[model samples]
Target: MSDALNVEGIIEFFEKNARHPLTPEEIARHLGVGRRDKKRLLAHLDELVERGILVQLKGRRYALPRKVNLVTGTISMHRDGYGFVSTGEPEGKDIFIPARFAREAMHGDQVLVRAERGIRSDKPEGRIVRVVQRAHQTLVGRFEQTRKFAYLVPSDPRLGQDIVIPRNARGKARSGQIVVARIDSFPSKNRNPEGTIIEVLGDPGDPEVEVLTIIHQHGLPHRFPGEVLAAAEEIPGEVLPEEFSGREDLRDLLTVTIDGETAKDFDDAVAVRDEGQGRIRLWVSIADVGHYVTEGGIIDREAYVRGTSVYFPGRCIPMLPEHLSNGICSLNPDVERLVMTAEMLFDAEGVRLESRFYPAVIRSRARLTYTQVRAMIELGDTEEISRQGEVYPALQVMKTLAERLQERRRLRGSLDFDLPEAEIVLDLQGNIEDIVRGERYFAHRLVEEFMLAANEAVAGFLSAREIPLLYRVHEPPSAEKLQQFQEFLSHFNLKLSLRQGQVAPRDLQQLLDQVAGRPEERMINQVMLRGMKQACYSPENVGHFGLAAHDYCHFTSPIRRYPDLVVHRILRGALGKKGLSEHEKQRLAQTLPEIGEQTSARERRAMEAERDIVALKKCQFMVQHQGESFAGIISGVQAFGLFVELKEFFLEGLLRVSSLGDDFYHFEEERHRLVGEHGRRVFQIGDEIQVRVEHVDVERRQIDFVLEGAPPAAAQGDVADDGDS
Candidate 1:
């Protein structure tokens, strides 16, 4: 071997063969470095170790950092400056980074970390060694200007540092204005990131401006690109004659779309009929969005990027442009719309006898609202029945079939939260008019049951044929979370039937049933929901725990959800070729995983943006109601305070323990309550009391409440001291 030295080559070789450790002599020999270059090779190895790219083992062998339990993943920075590295591995162990060790890593920043060896704990600990990729290219924050410079204090506290802007880099943004800043330089270990204001959002106090800030922070695109919109505008208003050649003609079927009164995008419709042999034939026709938004097109790329529609109180940022989502792709009544239908045959007991999938052309007979359907089916209002006309009979049969399916689901241990959602009624100018609980009637459940059956059938069929499909999976909860839940339920004298250190959905369902209609039902349901894992899209069939289904997928809302559209395209391809070709199969295998990951992330981003909007609006609404007393329940408790949820507004506010005034409250973590030191007053979840809205901070989206008096009689307990106010 010739005498030579290549530091970069040596590092690349170790990284490529990361699993194999090599001694210095072995590395030198493998790289063809002779005795003359031994000193150079040794110096390079020591340098690599210093840079944390390689680790020296006990036997004088060197290995890549990961071979010594190091991991590389994205950081989830906490507001308190500490963070956790989410290593996308099977074991799912996130390494916790303490505040001092965070190393200026911002939230969502990709970094390489090495696990702290010899830490015997459930959670792994690690420190960031290298910044692999920066997640934050644009930052949204409040701008503060000085004589010669400006800085941005990030609205997201997790960013943890203010960005300094040079005097000339400060654009039109003024002090105290909310702005979007483009990063000019990333932070080093000693200095904060430097950025300049790219766009001014406006005053932080303005509700509209606050919402825009959230949208920008989440990187949610509110407007379609010119090319995507141009593509959407190209889609025909009606299905072409040639396009109907392979589709079954079902225009005469009495199908109806049941949705909310304000819904414009009707992605799914249902029709049901009795088959007379203890069977029912149900047709779930979903909008054939894939037919128009072809794969690899601009519209398809945009939809894939969006993943799903983002809906706020009075606005919608749709996945597809309005021209498609609200026009051709919508299953509007009295128009011939193309659809992918699931023809499902079920017995009287709700067991699926046969199922088939095919493309079809259908004209929706009617567009019905949930309230109207509820009036017809549940209340039997004569006006509603007369108005429905021919569709009334079909709705009757669908109600029967839906009930049977729901019962079947109940028997299979599906966990239904049945929690009420807050409906924010806003005026034309976007001020909150009223906040009320949205009623869920039989109308909603009927459509839900039908969609569930269709999704299950499609997923089951695709799995049986060994076809590639995106499944909605929710893994089982961890033992630690479940155990904590059991401890919380102990306060209410409730217990879950755990088997073999694990709980089934039926166990949660039983607990929910017991708490149904009770005062604590809402609190218990919320706790159980927090204990469950989040559902996400996956290429693997892991089954859905919340639905308690062996197979489940998003197959009914292609117009709004990208996964459903992907499913439509796959099913369409499957129908033609029986199965994917080897080349197509290989392409799909590589593509679907990335699609799953990106779509899941998009869904979460949309959810967070939606939550931020609602919270902002609630704070704005409460700004006018300060000092007013309202009945509330202690929805949450921490060492810092008790969180109160108002009965009228459906808004939550913190009742800081220090505000108690009379005594020092001791936080009882095990019981999820606070105990007063001098007076022995105990406040916990589900305790009803009167609270006056003390203050509202719209900028921070915070509401502060003070206890008005002792809780109601029903809330009184032995722990409550007589001196409690």
Candidate 2:
């Protein structure tokens, strides 16, 4: 028998046969396994059973889980006590597990689910049959005490159960303090999980403690390991002369970096030149992080674990130690830094004529902030232009090329949501001073266009060489989501055209353009965004649906993103004009899939942590403004309430339906609105209304609002339009 007759072969045999459960002897006989391989075959069967891939039935028979109406996946618990199990298949729909059927599976736990009938055929329900792996060995929560014993209320509501902490296990933790607890016993159907306080963070309301809570709750790595730090310390702080031996010397290219004013780690620098006849040559140089952190080394291993840097309001948990992320690999101005450069030539219509990548050494001419670049380019400020000195001419060329590239993308049907992002301002003491819409000028878009061009160019380049690398893929929306979106647009007298049961990016872009300057513009944009699929890292290239590009990957910020660093390594191999060797390709092919999944999960964790901390800050800021009235727009409508976004502070709060004291109301699911039965009042998304800040719950990160005036009466079952008021 061949060595291939292992786990994979066993699964293949089961899949192909699709017969009744078979015993180990029967299965081995079917595969023609020899006597020497019998022990290995038995071990493989046991491993599959443990992984929930194969279920060992009664009488020592084995069958695929699906054959027994069982699905294996990670369970994601909702705050309302129910959970959903994701099968991790591209076309698989989540199986809903009701609160009663959830059993003991908590959020993120991999479990075996027994399929059950549900009301909707499209949505299947299931019950947890077994927990294959526990997601949380420890949890962060608020400490609480009673007369006899203490317990922890998990900061993450999805946990669904409080962990009981025995008196002896409480340690120095006091009531109302944030603490980390290690689970001593997992939750069961009849009892909650038991844990001991491992570390007490601090009082909940403290700014530092609030941030720390989110960090621990999400399991983010905040500090570098000593070995990783020592490895980083071993690297030189400056680029040596011999380091540029085999690299192109672009030190005199008048290159400049454009970033936020507060940015310390500059990863990308750009230089542009007009080559006459509406032709432009652009160079995008990114920090050569892979050159320093070799693969599978101490630093590389830690960076792989971190996946990506996590940024909060005033702090960041960097992927690499500061010595590398902020020093030699940073590409700081006036210092010679090693970089992987993407050089391309583009014509007037923003069509890429030619592109190439190479290792290079560059001395940055200047570091420019987005605000300054905007002033110089958009406002044509003389002082700002003069202040840039030697790089002024290059900035002008950069602006022209960026505009052409942006227009090309717009013409090609790229979706630009342009949604407002909250920029949290902090005082000297780290307390939130204000929350406002972040400024996004054309200058920001200018850099974005360049980065997109380089990313696509590099992806296309490496893909042509047949190298395996991670691609930033954004698949199209599903047909069901498109139908729901079309229904929503119909309520606003709008329509989304679908081609062959699929809506194209251009169709959505057209709809966006039609709704510009209208009252429902923001609401429609948000809904359309929700309908689209999330972009993730994958070894297989599905193309980026939102960008409307055939090839796309993240290649600009290798310092912060692991996927970018991976791409850089592949690009470097191809730079020698000889792509990766057979051994290297085989290794990557075997590992890239798992790497993609791990990095994507870590990315989501970082995003969730960032969102939680920002919401906490917003709630804290709103505490002082309780009971004050503000103009707002109904951003979301659900059965229980309407979520209103305040105009002044950009904070969102719920206006519960029960608070509509004038009349009884019912939710119109299709219309996405709440309608009063007797008064004929309406509360729908995009409707401008006045709301008073009734309450703010910092612990739960919630804000509650009440109507400022009596509910406005409208025609029966009619949506309030912009002209209605």
Candidate 3:
């Protein structure tokens, strides 16, 4: 009897239940013994069943069957009524929920599940008993209307289900426009769930429509509530004496803001000078937004949830109201602003010599744009220049320091891509007027390199002191990804083997220097970039492999990113009679993973939205000059076709497989190449191919093309009419 209850377990079958059956092998696993030890434990478990102390289900799987309380999990419903209860943990497999037992739970709803004794699989099965939490209170999508009802096709790919709207609940859904909807009736046995369209966005093709749709889809608030805006407006413009007294007076530090001419919200400024002995002193002054927005205050909570300011193509969705982001907290020239400053001394080698971060009040002496600085520094004493009287000398000194820093960084492992960046000039109606490539001059490089140095210096200082703070980390690529990349390089007879960890950043930079001015430079660098993971803020400081920095953080741009703001607050606390609570410190450690996830996700969304808009504009540009011949490179190849990007406009389009004549073409996945079956003709990615525009599908955002000087074995009728596709 004692042996029967030997195993530590939750279930204890009574003698009446044991009358059913048992197998020693089944009872071993059931009794919580290791599978490897099942043979010995199995003998004991079988004796328990023989002694009438345990029961076995069919298939000889032993269990002490009882009416146990159920555990709760999220119900992942399907288009059909049937669903499964999925636990939050990664290891837990989902429990099946049959239609009869799955009450009215919709997709993404947390629900109570009762484990029932029934036919079972590898894991337990359950029936949904009660609803707990609903994932989304509102949804954004394009609406489709009929005479009797309306439906919303969700904008988010993860949503997975269309929302049905009754005629009375349609509210204001237009046939083909985006709208936000609130779910009303959940799906039941006889009827589809109903929703009310709460908002109506504009047409799909418009750029504004795209940005707003994305913001709505993510449930990110684009505009502040009236009360919040009012609260922000009431904040006083003047700085208190108490605020100015505790800060370092960097007002006469010759600090200058170097940003784009169009930028109104200046968040960071740069100041650098030769400290002699082949050393340089660099200081990055970030606008102290945290001082104006206090902890647990209205603006602070809003910024915390928003986390970071989102910059759309033409506009920005400021985390704080404009009164602070663009006005009081902005680092305007000749105006005193609170700041969190990082000052570092570096030898000519660009390595920071023990840095210090402190709270300061600084006056930005000049607001210089990249255009003006580039012209003044490079083409000194020219038209539209030489207006600077007070700060011109200091700008020159700063420019020299930046050049030294750049030289040192290049000698190290920094991968200076210097890729062409596209910028759109929009008309008053928000239509694209011109697409310009932003130039990278010494002045721009100076600010960037200095800010990077300052950020790293501050991060290193905190780490050396063993302070827990958010750090920006970038690890080396996975071995699998690196191997594939190495294979890609072997095609050009270029071999790079990373020793153990990341290959030296300097080695990668040397490879870049070798490939510069070559035809394959763009393709090679782009692929190399794709192999590296994005850098993000976290409490765990795994050194950045790309920048080759041992420690890094976002101490600049407090106006844009929340972590920077947090750093600013910490600096304030260190200088004042205060420190963060243990709760806040613990909260920082706990929330790092979640913060990393959301920030990374949102950053991708922003990039995707930008890419989509640019591609659409490129397609539109192609539409205007459809018949014109252009030289392009084969950017991608698949079984169906080849994707070509034009050299003239940097636009991309697909050359359909049918355009390659009657030959059947198959894509070689391993080699990244496409081969023609009949003629044995081959086309590879990164090959230069000229193509003419054949068709454009604006609705699907796809462009079609036909190869130039190639015989059409199969005449192209439609974009998808590619043979062997």
Candidate number of the best lDDT? 2
Report the C-alpha displacement of residue 698, candidate 2, in angstroms: 1.8
The top-ranked prediction according to TM-score is 2
- Tell me the spans in candidate 1 whose CA falls farther than 4 Å from its real position: 1-64, 88-94, 117-125, 577-579, 709-725
Off by over 4 Å in 2: 119-123, 709-725
Better of 1 and 3 by lDDT: 1
Q: Quote each prediction's TM-score.
A: 0.88, 0.95, 0.77
Worst window of 10 by summed lDDT in candidate 3: 1-10
* Location of the lowest summed lDDT over 10 successive residues in candidate 1: 716-725
Per-residue CA lDDT of model 3 for 307-377, tens digit only, reads 77776557887778899988888998887888888888887665667677788888888888988887788
Estimate the TM-score for candidate 2. 0.95
The CA root-mean-square deviation of candidate 1, after full C-alpha superposition on the true structure, stands at 6.0
Q: Order the numbered candidates by lDDT, best leading.
A: 2, 1, 3
lDDT of 1 by residue, 46-73 (tens): 8877655676777999888677777768
lDDT for every model?
0.85, 0.89, 0.72
Q: How far is candidate 2 from the true structure (C-alpha RMSD, Å)?
A: 3.8
Q: Write the per-residue lDDT of candidate 2 for residues 1-725, one digit (tens) a residue.
A: 86557888888889998499999889878988888998999999989988888988899999988888988999989777889999987668899999987759889999999988787765789899899889899999999998988999999888979999998999999898999999999988888999999999999788898888899889998988888899899999999888999999999898999999878899999998899999999999999999899988989999999999999998989998999999999989999999999999999999999998899999998999999999898899999888888777888888899999999998999999958899999888998888999999998998999999999999998888788889999999988889888888998899888777688788889899999988778889998999888899999999999999988999999999999999998888877666678998998898999999999999999998998888899999999998789999998888777889888997788877767777888999777899999989998878999988887888778887888864432112333221100
The residue ranges of model 3 lying beyond 4 angstroms of the native Cα positions read: 1-137, 155-162, 185-194, 203-207, 240-242, 576-598, 619-629, 666-688, 708-725
